[model samples]
Target chain A: MKSLDFFVYLFIMAGVTYLIRVLPFVIFKGKITNTFVKSFLFYVPYAVLGAMTFPAILFSTGNYAASAAGLAVACVLAFREKSLLTVAIFACAAALIVNLIAMAIQ
Target chain B: MKYFKKGLHDGIPIALGYVSVSFTFGLQAAGYGMYWWQAVLISLTNLTSAGQFAGLDIMVRGAGFWIEMACAQLTINLRYSLMSLSLSQKADKSLRGVHRWITGFGITDEIFAVAMGSNKDVSRHYMYGLILLPIIGWTLGTLLGAVAGQVLPEVIRNSLGIAIYGMFLAIIIPPSKKNHAVLKVVIIAALMSCVFKWLPLLSNVSSGFVIIICTVAAAAVGAVFFPVKEDSQ
Candidate 1:
C-alpha cells in the first residue's frame, strides 16, 4: 500500500475504534435495563480474553503438548492464587521446557 | 498534573507488559519485511496486539479499504467497546468533558482492569498515569524490538514471543479457579475455537469471525447459566 493509503487506513481505524469505544457511553447515559444483557456484558471480557489466549497458548505450533504443560503449570499456580507475574513466568518456563523436550525426542 | 501521576503509576505495570509484548510484534513486523520505522510507527499509532496483527495481515495481502476496516473493527479490538462501557460506570462522578474525553484514550484491557479495580476517585491525574506509562512502554518496546531483531538470535525471539500468552494465561486461570462458571466459559470458548481450527468445514472462516462467534457464544452461554444475582453489582 502507498504511504497515503496506509495513513488513511490508520486514520479510519483509529476513528472507528474511538467511535465504538465512545458511542455507547454517550448514547446510553445510564439506560441499561435488561438483566441478561447486563450479566452477559459482565462476562464478555473474561470470555473474550480467554478465547483470545487459549488457542495461542495451546495450538500456536499446531500441537497440544507444550500448551498442555503450560496450562497445567498455570492452573497449579493460579489455584494457589499466586501473583500474576509469577504465574506467567512459571507457565512460560513449563511450555518452553516441554517444547524443547518434544523437539529433542523428535 | 494529578492525572499525569496517576497515569504514571497505573501505567507502570502496563508498560512492563507492553514492552515485552510489543517487542515480539516489532520483531514479527521486521521479519515480515516491514522496515524498522514501519514497525515502530504501527506500535506508536495502534498500540494494540490483535489489531496490529490484523493490520499486518491486510498489509501482506494488500487488502482494500473495506477489508482493512472490517478486519480491524471485527477481529482484534471489538472488546474495547465492552471495556469502555464498564469503565464509564467506574469513572469519577465529577469527571467532566475533556478529562473524560482524554481518559478513554488509555483504556487498554490491562489499564482498564487496574483503573476500574481502583476504589479511589478517578481523578484526571490518575487517568493520565493510566495512559502515559503504557504508551511509553509499548512504543519504546517496539522500537527496541525493531533494533533487537537485527541482532537477536531466532531462538531467543521465539522464546520471548510466548510472554504475552503467558501473561494472558495468568490473567484467566486465577479467576476461573474461583468461579466455576468462568471456568466453564473458558473451556467452552477454547473447545469452540479448537473446533473452528481443526474442522475442515470451518477452516475457511477468518480469525475475526472466530473471535466474534466464540466470544458471543461463550458469553451468551455463561449469561444463561451463570446469571449474576441482582444485588451483586
Candidate 2:
C-alpha cells in the first residue's frame, strides 16, 4: 500500500471506531426512562461479550480438543472467581497440554 | 488521584493479557512483511484486536482493498457503540466532551467491562489511568513482537492465543455467577452465535455482523425476560 493510502485507511478505521463510541455519550444526556430500553442496554455487555466469546473461543486453537480444554479450564476458574491472570494462565497451560497430546496422537 | 491509582492497579491484569495477544498480532504483521514501525502504528491507531487483524489483511492484499478495510473495521468495531452506550449510563456528566473523546477512543472490550463494572461512576482521570497501561502494553507488545519476529516457538504462540479468550471468560463468568439474568443472557447469546455460525443463510454473513445481530437479539430477549429494576440499572 502507498504511504498516503495506508494513512487514509488508518484515518477511516480510527474515525469510524471513535464515532461509534462517542455517539452514545453525546446523545444520552438524560436518564433513559423506557424499561425495555434500559433492560436492553443493561444486558448488552453480557450479550456482546458472550456472542463474541463462545463458538469463537472453541475454534481458537489449532485442535478442537485443545481449545475445548482451554475453555473448560477458563469456565471452571472464572466460575470460582479466580483473578483474570490466573484464569488466563491456567487455561493457556491446559490448552498447551491438550494441544501437545493431540499432536502426539497425530 | 485515588481513582488514578486504583485504575492503574486494576489495569495490570488486562495489560498483561494484551501483551500476549497483541504479540501474536504483531508476529502476524511481521509475517505479512510489515515493518516494526508499521505494526506499531496499526496497534496505536486501531487498538482493536479483531478490526486490526481484519484491516491487516486488507493492507497485505492490496491498496485497492480499502473498501474491505472500511467494511471490516465498521462491522467489527460496531460493538463498541453498544458498549459505550451502556457505559454512557454509568459515566458522570462532569466528564467533558474532551474526556469522552479521549476515553471513547480507547474503549476496547476488556476496558469497557472493567469500567462498567467499577464500583464508582467512571471519571475522566480514572479513564485516563484505566486505558493508559493497556494502551502501552498493546503498543509495546506489537513493537517487541514485530522486532522479535519469528523468535518464539510455534507451540508457545498458539498457546498464547487461548489467553485472550480466557480473559473474556474471566470478565463474564463472575458476573454471571451472581446474576442469574446475566447467565441466561450469556447462554442465549452463545447459542445464537452457534446458530449464526451454522445455519444456512445466516452463516453466510460475516462474523462481525453475526456478533451484532446475535447480541442485539439476545439482549432484547433478556430485556423482555429479565428486566432489571430501572433504578438498579
Candidate 3:
C-alpha cells in the first residue's frame, strides 16, 4: 500500500486509541463513584485480553499442533507467575521446536 | 529526580517485555510487506498491540472501512479509558494542565500497572521516566524486527507469530490465578470468543465486532454477578 493510504488507517488507530486513553484522565478529576462501572472497568482488561488471545493463538503459528504447544507452554508459565518476557520467549521456543519436529517427521 | 529514577527502575521489566512482544508485531507487519519505517511509525503512534494488529488488517485489506477501523480500535482499546480513569485518581498536582494529556498518552497496560502500584502519588516526571524506555524499546524492537523479518528464515519468522499472544496470556493469566472472579471472566470471554468463531450464524460476525461483543458481555457478567468490593483495590 502507498504510504499515504497506510497513514490514513494509522491515523485512525492512533487517534481513536489516544482519545480513549486521554479523555477519561482529562475529564474525570475525582473518583468514579459508581460501583458497577468501577468493577466493569477493573475486569474489562482481563476479559478483552482473554478473548483476544485464545482461538487466535491457536491459529497464529504454521499449524494447530505447534500453536497448541506454544499455548500450553504459555499458560503453564503464566499460571506459575512467570514474567511476561519469559512466558513469551518460552512459548515461541516451544512452538518453534514443535514446528521443527513436524518438519522432520514429514 | 528520585521519583523519576524510581519510575525508571520500576519500568525495566515492562520495557523488556514490550521489546519481545513488539518484536512479533514488527515481524507480522513485515510479513505483510510493510516498510520498516512504517511499522515503526505505527508502534510509535499507537503503542498498542491488539489495536495495531487489528488496524493493520483493515488498512491492508478493507481500504474503505475507516469507521470500522475506528470502532475496532475504540472497542479493543476501551479498557485504556478505564485504566486512565483509575490513574487520574492517583494523579498529584503535577499531573494537571498539559501534563495530564501527556501522561495519558503513555498509559499502556503495563505503564498503568506500575504507576498504580506505586504507593506515592503519580507525578508528571515519574510518568515521563516510566514511559520513556518502553516507548524506545517498543519502537526499536519494531524497527529491528521489521528489518530482520525481510531476511530471516521463514520458519523463524512464522514461529514468532505466537509471541504476542503469549504476552497476552501472561498479562491475564496471573491475575486469574489469584482471583476466582477474574478466572471466571477469562473463561467466559474465551468461550464466547470460540463460539463466535465457530458457531454457524455467529461465524459471519466481523472479527472486530466479535471481540467487542465478547468483551462487553463477559465484563458485564463479571460486574453484575461479582461486583468488586469498594475497598478491594
Question: Ten residues in a row with the worst lDDT in model 1 chain A?
Answer: A24-33
Give the Å shift of residue B76 in candidate 2.
2.0
Interface RMSD of 3: 3.1
C-alpha RMSD (angstroms) for model 3: 3.7
Pairwise TM-score winner, candidates 1 and 3: 1
Q: Residue B51: error of model 3 in Å?
A: 4.1
Tens digit of per-residue lDDT, candidate 3, span B1-233: 98788778766667766776688788888888888889999999999877888887887784678898889898778778867877887788888879888878899867886676566889988998899888888898788788875565767766877877877787887777778999999899999999999999999886766776887889899999999897785
Model 3 chain A worst lDDT window (10 residues): A41-50
Docking level for model 2: medium
Runs in model 3 deviating more than 4 A are A1-13, B1-35, B50-79, B86-97, B109-130
Best model per lDDT = 2
Q: Lowest-lDDT window of 10 residues in candidate 2 chain A?
A: A24-33
**lDDT by residue (tens digit), candidate 1, B1-233:** 76667557656656766887788788778777777887887777666777777777677665476665755665567777777776665566555566666667667767765665455646667777678878888988888887876565444444444555555665666677777888898888888888888899997877766767887899899889888777464
Question: Can you give the lDDT of residue B223 in candidate 2?
Answer: 92
Please write out the lDDT profile of model 1 over residues A1-106, one tens digit for every residue: 5776667666766666666666654444453567788777767767766767767666542347766776787778767866556666676677678767877788
- State the lDDT at B158 in candidate 3: 66
DockQ of 1: 0.47
- Of the pair 2 and 3, which is ahead by TM-score? 2
DockQ of every candidate = 0.47, 0.72, 0.60
